[model samples]
Target: MDTQATSAPAADVTSLPPVEVDDAEAALVEHYPRLVRIAYLTLSARLGRHRRVLLAHRVAQRSLPRGRRVPEVVEAGTDPAYAVVRLATLRGALARADRVDGWRRWARSAGNAVPVPPRVIGLRLFPRAGGSEELALDRALARLDAPARAAFALRGVEGLDEESTARLLASAGVAAPRRAVRDAAMSGVNASLLVSGEFDPCVLQARPTDLVRRRQHVRAGVGAALAVVVAAALLGVPGSDGGTEASGPPGSAQAALAQALDPASLLRADATAWQRADRLDFASWPARGDRTGDQALLGRALSAWGRPGASVHVSATAGTPSTPPAAPPRLLFAGDVDGAAIVLLYDGVRLVRYAEPLDGGSGTALDFARVDGALGASASAVVLARSDGNASYLTAPWISGVSLRDLLSPSAAPQAIHRAADGVTDPVPSAQAATDANCGTAGATWPAIRLTPRAGVPGLAPFVLTDLGDLAPAHLTYATGRGAVPAEATSADATAAWAHSACRLASVRGEGVRTVNTWAFADQPLPDGAGTAQWLCTRADDWSGDDHVLVQFLPPGSAPDTPAAVSASARSTAACGPLQPGVLSGVLWKARDGRWYLLGAGSPEVASLTATGGPRSTSPTRTLVVPARQTTQAELTGRLTTGGTLDALK
Candidate 1:
């Protein structure tokens, strides 16, 4: 638009001046040299080195407006001139490229057709001394598909931050570009050593996030619990439809269901249903002949409902066309209620039958696309929504006649989900077979994986979080929250130690093939709060997924009105109690009687402690299980392992 040939230094373009199109264009023109280098290196592998220089020039100039009017920059934080020109360039190149992957593009030309090793891509962009390694790197870059090549070039080569690279690639029309950038960067870095001949790039282990789709549903549901905590405590719980079933195309039943319910409205309806209905049917089954078939179990679930100030409202855009299901498509509804968040499922006509209150405590988030994709291949779709509180996760399907209570219970593993019968596998058959075969004696369980450096472990690459438009790196950010990773945490032994120290009870669950490790924290009393203790639970896995606090518990009779104090030392001490040894203390408080009390969740083997009259060691003089509400403590003489925290009961 601004064709005025004026010379000036290049503007950073990080923050372009609005309404100053002429100046912006001039700045971009001045920066063309730098832009060309970026473009050439970024696109060369995909378009082949021969055409890279020409394509780069075209991409830069074409990014400029062809018409008289300059277009407004649609995306925030992007330079209007440069971003437009770069995006245009990418589009033009893609049009000409052969055999480009729609989702992950690559070059199809004979010379650049092989799968490139990521290390080679890195070296090409950031050329170290040219040698066999450089040649190898060139070969690798040539072989990579377009998306991976672009990712490596931008983040790995250009050294752009993930956010910047994702934005640039996304502007160029890549699906899940943010995810792709992260993978490419990590893979590139990991592959750097492979060129040394000591390591094989193919043998490199897959990052957990790499192999599995981040459990967006479960991740989001963690915060969903806080929304429903109050109402859920009083009432009860329960638990997607979209495109198609994995079996083939969408069947009549699946299509009818997707059409029957508006995704957002249906979710709102289900949330409201939990509050209003004293006795309601599970979502898996419609009102068949006017009798609520699962009345008895449904009643137990409903008992947790009926509290004031409960709200799980779906935004207008919720369940919009962002994620389209196929074959036997399932519907997903995720929102916050009361103060917590909840995810509900719809099998067309009814809600998911589980009927348990879904709650993810504070700081919960969801990725709907990942949830849909994980279940995309399953015949009977299973939704992984958080149960009331964060202590447990429910991986049950929305099928009629299925008992959620039994399925969720350890003894009655649902037939559909038991063993390898029904679980997530790679969309690619070969990849799926690799995972299945690896899950033999070495595999801990469906959800429990033993992280090892061995070659045979299933490759766990991070899948794209399609629904996470801007928060694609959320998983990485969460991982750094607690503090630095200790040296011991480098291996499985350290991770297991961390778990046993912090959680009295821990388990793993498989959602569409991705494994998430869940843990329950001991109930610990708030500082200076004699009557109440706190219960906190979390979930995480190796690779990128970080520990998310699933539930935050405040015990009954505790100082509910008072805000909690920051007790870093107390929390650290309780996580792995020196006095308690292997026993993790949930909460600790000193009673007015000068005796200290500790609370915990689950069934823990607590060693006995004895104290008698006149402060002399004697036969157990006093011992009591810390009740939810207690202001007085006479003495400490008994082994105490509290049965339930506020969330554990849920």
Candidate 2:
């Protein structure tokens, strides 16, 4: 058995008080290097390299003495006893340095300084996977919520399991759930390997005496003058030029890095034609460790992924799961009509990734399936789902085209980008089709109802589209008919017409439209006389919200009625007339489940039906209710049997 993997005699020594300061100090002296590395890793991203070194030392100085107050036998051979203490100290030190925003702000700012990678002197948990993996790991770590990132870093980098990880976090004043800790650990390990850096077997063999001398020598070498330079730059100290290095525009190196990683620049090249010639020019990007291979892969992915006549347009802003990526979140755009198979990807700074279209065309009518997108726990394959009667799974290496023909289903589902195909069946008929069949424009297409994708996890939910704009005039006309529409009516006029049609005797005082869940339209609170000449109710429904209309037409002189007021107890109330003793007709709406119902309706004889309170019943009440699904034409037809008007009740 490797003695290095073994722990001290006690597994739970956190609560144990230090029995001997001398013994613990001796052990800490030997483990100082490892402790310093931990502190450096934790603070470097938030504080600049110089400040990180300072804060890291502060953490070590604070942690070493804790061995005396809480003596524990954590030596080089066993798990370090000060692991928990080091993490706690680092968190506190960062707070004191006021570098809480750290490198995070630099990453988001447009033309800031280039990030200095964290330094690693010893210990290789994993071999270098190259700068790409480093970039990937850094992005993954950045996206994690603070608690999750801390829990994951400690558990994975320090080899603490969930239980121990939770305890460590709690000791640092952070409340973490066991499940979240476990999740962070599982998500963090691979990335943490790149982060922890290459382990140094040589450091393991060094004695405490040699490390102490080396530490002192290095401090003496840095000297006061070098510290002064860094402090001056950080403190905005004026120079001979009357400005500091930071006050000047970004240095040439930083400007180049920013340009190389900028997504907008890469996308501009790919706009007119799929094969971006400008991007093909290797001189456009910063020189990479493997420039030849990176350029080749990027070229192939972009060239083969696009279709002729596809117009590239930015679709949505892609964000990672937990933290911001090294580059700003990539901009995801869709190619024109023919390019439905291709989704362009650009890291805010570069076109690092792109999607190649599947071999055969998706027979379904829709080109892209609009679904919620999500990030994976690990670096997962980019999956493609088709309405080709099957879902295809493919993975693109750092720089290559993943053929749709060679698609293979992985044992586990990878993060996918689902695209709906042509000829596929739509759950709800098109707005044109849903309109009254007798209406003149029954076959006309409603651009407002075009299927548009939303940002969410790829495969968890079905891809659905929402209306890009508000309901068209034809749709409103279909719902209320020509009888309700006045000559040259405005949108408000149409609404009033529908209200008057619904309740013939009642004047149209006000009208409103709501989504399925009761989210009001922009014109929800229009004045009594507000009116528009054209169909201007342009409220694009959120795809997740589902575009289902709920019309609430208030009778000229009445208030909206609650469901309870129109049911059971108030059946005998004088205000409720012969209509049904207690039915509400003020709010009439269509439901997705193919049903139409009247809500807050009162007796026709009474202008306003007011309900009196009564006893509650144990049994369910019988009342007309709308199903919360996409409304269909058949249901609308059934409910509007009397020509889209409920005037018969009045």
- TM-score of every candidate relative to the true structure: 0.23, 0.25
Q: What shift in Å separates residue 528 of candidate 1 from its native position after superposition?
A: 44
Task: List candidate 1 stretches off by more than 4 Å.
Answer: 1-35, 38-312, 315-650
- Model 1, 300: alpha-carbon shift in Å? 19
Q: lDDT tens digits, residues 1-650, model 1?
A: 12212222233544544435564467458656545444554454444333454555555555555443343323444345554554555565545444354444423445557533222211112222233334445445545556666666554333455666676677677888867766566543433322332111111222122222234434444423322332212211121112123532234533432332223223223323322433222332112111123334323222212111223211111222221222122323232232333343432322232222334332333222222222311112323332232111222222222211110112322222221212221111111112222222232122211111213213222111100111111111111112122121223332332222222112211211222222223343343555545433333322123222233344546321222221222211122211222222233345676665443332133334332221323222111244333343122233444421111111
- Consecutive 10-residue window with the lowest summed lDDT within model 2: 505-514
Candidate 1 displacement at residue 199 in angstroms: 26
Q: Write the per-residue lDDT of candidate 2 for residues 1-650, one digit (tens) a residue.
A: 11122222335556555545565455456665555555544443434334445456556656645433552323233434454355445465434433534466555444535533333443212222223334345445545555666565555455655665566566666655575576676663473453334321112221122243244334423432232323222212221234445653355433432333333434322222212222222111121111213433333333222211133222221111111122222323332223234332433222222333334443322121111211121111222232232323222111121111000111112232333331121222222222222222222221111111223323322211112111101111211211111121123333233322222101111111111111111121212233311111111122121222223343232211110111111111111111112222333334334454333332222232221111111111111233222232111101222221111111
TM-score attained by model 1: 0.23
